[model samples]
Target: MTFDPVMPGIVLAVAAATLLALRAVALLPAARAGRTSVARWAVTTVALLLLVLAAARPVTGSAAGERNAQRPQEGANIYFLVDRSSDSAIPDFGDAPRITAMRSDIEEVIRAHPDARFAIIGFAARPSIDWPLSADAWSLQPAVDALTPYPGIDSTEVNAAAAANILRYQLISAGQQFPQAENLVYYLGSGAGESTVPQGVFDTPRIDDGAVLGYGTGPGEARLREIAGQLGLPYVPRRDGAELPSDRAPESGTATATDPATAPQPTELYWVLTMLATALLLVEIYLTTRDLRRTRAVRRQAPS
Candidate 1:
């Protein structure tokens, strides 16, 4: 059993204690008068405790199972290095902006690897991690959709390898953390940028699969192909109305995808605890009402 409290543990504890203390004090006079039975007080106390437990959001699972639930099972770790340079806004691929092709290709990659963990790093004048590596792949859509090219007027020279160092560090860290998981890198760009390809940046064996998807027509297209060759990834050019080929074979073991039947899922006990608390509260209410009616009858029978 574990707890993922809706509120801070200390705050919940203090609140529960305060409520329990107040309830005890409020029932003291009734207890002395014999109007509130010990059973009623006991039931209410238990109910209050149960209510607190429910709020704490308890989950039942083994420690190992819980850890497994948090970590991605044997699946690819996909890193998307997107160029948000001013050139990316140039409408060249079938009269659509390079960003449009980038978005489409990203979605296609995501769909191709449904179980893969995804991360996004967008670069223009500089690089920034738009999203961290996570199993929730669909959550990355909004971030990708919101990407806009860096303002042309104020834009500095965007280099192809602007995010190379960051990508290297992330790949190393990910390799260390999840050695069994394959690391895939997708570089999406118009390839119209200063060629600052760092030496041996893509030399790491961590990169297992992915591609360099170039957009638009320019002399930089050759540079993009060079970048793809250095990374030992496929180079796909997005020409007029050209879409990414869908026939690419899955590289990793598809059978290794996390099976829902065997996956460790936290058993939420909050609702169960809540139901018990409700039942106890109802019993407490019934007992209190019975005691009130008995007191009223006794008062009526007494001489003035």
Candidate 2:
């Protein structure tokens, strides 16, 4: 049993005991004649005790159940690995830069999965974590919105070595960061460039579910498919005015997000305690009033 009290449980217990003691001192005289005061005290004490217990949020469950209650509801982690190479700045999807389209797509994905955890990794000359694994999607918006093309590179192509290295590192990091969670990786890029790293050199983590999402319909599209094939993930290419593949993104209104950590579920036993307390209080009031009326009738009938 667990009790989450407004004040410490011990403090409430002590206060309840003190109040009972004071009530006994005031009501003990009636105990000798009719035991009425003693009955009232018992009912009042029980009611007050139940109130305190309810306030404490007493819960009874197995150790494992209790542990699960404290943790967030199990959900998938959706990690976005975006390309920040110079090639991403190329004007592709309807006059807007590829990065612009990527950012909009990322936001759309975020809005689609209101309940999922999200992380962002941008790779170019070097791969870096734009946002670590987090439940707060709002915090990731600025990073994704502020994405700029990596500068000072000799070529406008994606750096294969940097992309591969960053991808491997972020995958390993995500595994460490959320070991128990299921992860879905989304690789967003043109897939047109070549990495100097040899094939099969970079280690791809065992991803549970993912998709390789490519932007633009240029030469890099084939390279993107190749990369997806190499990684054993499904490839989905985006074009101007085309809908994203349904399999890659979730539909609207299907997000099942977890409530805040401290929010108790409907199954909590506090409600039962409250009901019991109310019943006891009502009984105590009725008994006390009846006893008072009986005493008054006895006094009125006595010789005076």
Candidate 3:
């Protein structure tokens, strides 16, 4: 984990040392009780260590962006904030969903802006980064292409907060002001129903990455057509009042579009798996607290 703060690990290690030292002062009964004190101290220290590691913000195998050092690139730092909720999986035109088309468009932007660094943000199932800002279009395209909205994370409510988070992440990763003041900040999803941003993240400075590549058209309606009941998918338009339809509108419900069941889209979601590992740890802490309380109660009842 890369520690951005001054000696973040050292500070955390020192804090742990201090806690161990503090435990040295516990009452004799607890301290001397059958290695109970030693075990308690060890457990607490490990928990603190884990939390510190997360706060340290260690990334996955340092991205080359750190070494890139910002050379002159042609396009601006282009980013995509995609909706990975259930709706993204539905069809848009032929067989593919609007989200699929959106990813294709993003890749096109990456290709067109070869020099411009790129990053992606998944807004649902926990807002996070799919890849760091970099110029490698090949790597970036796959990462963008494989994204699938996590189960139960669909939010049509205009999530400016999530969008802002996406915007901030891209610019910061690029390590400069966005658009070079002439480019665009892109948002891809349905921002039609959301009324309020609870965290007020929109108030912050946001680079307008041009227009919106919204996934679905109207409210509650996400449409896509099948390709002759075959393996290909094309765009199917949804005429909803909330969105400004894309120039490449989906064919009407009656039109016959081709559905090419393209290879199953790949989504790199290892981070979500990491969070699962943490749950076991929470159970450990709970057990520790329960045992500690039971010991105290037993001591209280003993006759001196």
Candidate 4:
């Protein structure tokens, strides 16, 4: 229940006006006669409206949220660790290389599972959070769109270190509310030869997460990237080459990606607004009926 304003002031004003109007209507004699408690009704409407508006969370620009599945599913929290360092610039995978392809893949993943709380992180010579764990894919998607290969300092950190950082953050944010079996990590990197973090970092007993995918064709080929501004800085070389490590045993995991067409689309804000309005209307109807009953009782008791 948070509100970000693309037009915060306007939304607040509208909400306030609506609340006042409801209050005025509730104060009228006909409306007043039927309520168990008008004050309580007014307060409840306001509270409900606030909750609805909080979902609005107006942003300066359009943002997307994942729709509920046709079959209800509890959202799984997942984190993404990306290799954004200078090395991805090696024209590694796409015509533009691995970074762009990786970015596109991320956007697709988020588009499909927009409701999933996710964080995007970049590791090169070092690690920095591109987007923290959030349900509001509104901001998170943009963070994905803004992925660039341009120069930042030179510091390459291992994907494991980044995963560790992501794990730490998830624990802090979810706290007691954390769902068991809810957390997963996807590390999409070249698995560059050397990194400071332990190889089993994602395999520990404390957090039984494992790296899902690796990109690049040859040995040490996956680790290629450059931070030059030609592709606008932190670009992975332009090649479609990727590899599943020969050393590790293969297993089916949740990290398998969906086709672009079949991927999920975002839930529209207006639909949410409509549902909220419908709920409010139902509440109003109930209140009206209750009030009518009270008025009838009053008349019955009045002198004929």
**Number of the predicted model whose TM-score against the real structure is largest:** 1
Instruction: Output the better candidate (1/4) by TM-score.
Output: 1
Which pairs of residues have clashing backbones in candidate 1?
Answer: none
Comparing 1 and 2 on TM-score, the stronger one:
1
lDDT per prediction?
Answer: 0.75, 0.69, 0.50, 0.53
Give candidate 1's error at residue 13 in angstroms: 18
175-223: candidate 1 lDDT, tens digit per residue: 8767777888999986654445432235555588888988875677887
Give per-residue CA lDDT, model 3, range 1-304, as digits (tens). Answer: 2222223468867876776676556535556775765565555555555555544444333432332222332345556666666656668547777676766666666655544557677764346777655544555666876887666543543343355555555555444543332234455655323333342233224443344455565542221121101112223333322333332222466321111131121232333434643664666678788989999999999999
> Looking at model 1, which ten-residue stretch has the lowest summed lDDT?
193-202
RMSD of each: 11.7, 17.6, 13.0, 15.6
Q: Global CA lDDT of candidate 3, please?
A: 0.50
lDDT at position 252, candidate 2 = 67
Q: Tens digits of per-residue lDDT for model 2 on 196-219?
A: 433222357877677788887666
TM-score of each: 0.60, 0.55, 0.44, 0.46
Which stretches in model 2 have alpha-carbon errors above 4 Å?
A: 1-73, 194-202, 247-304
TM-score of model 4 (CA atoms)? 0.46
The positional error of residue 5 in candidate 2, measured at the CA in angstroms, is 25
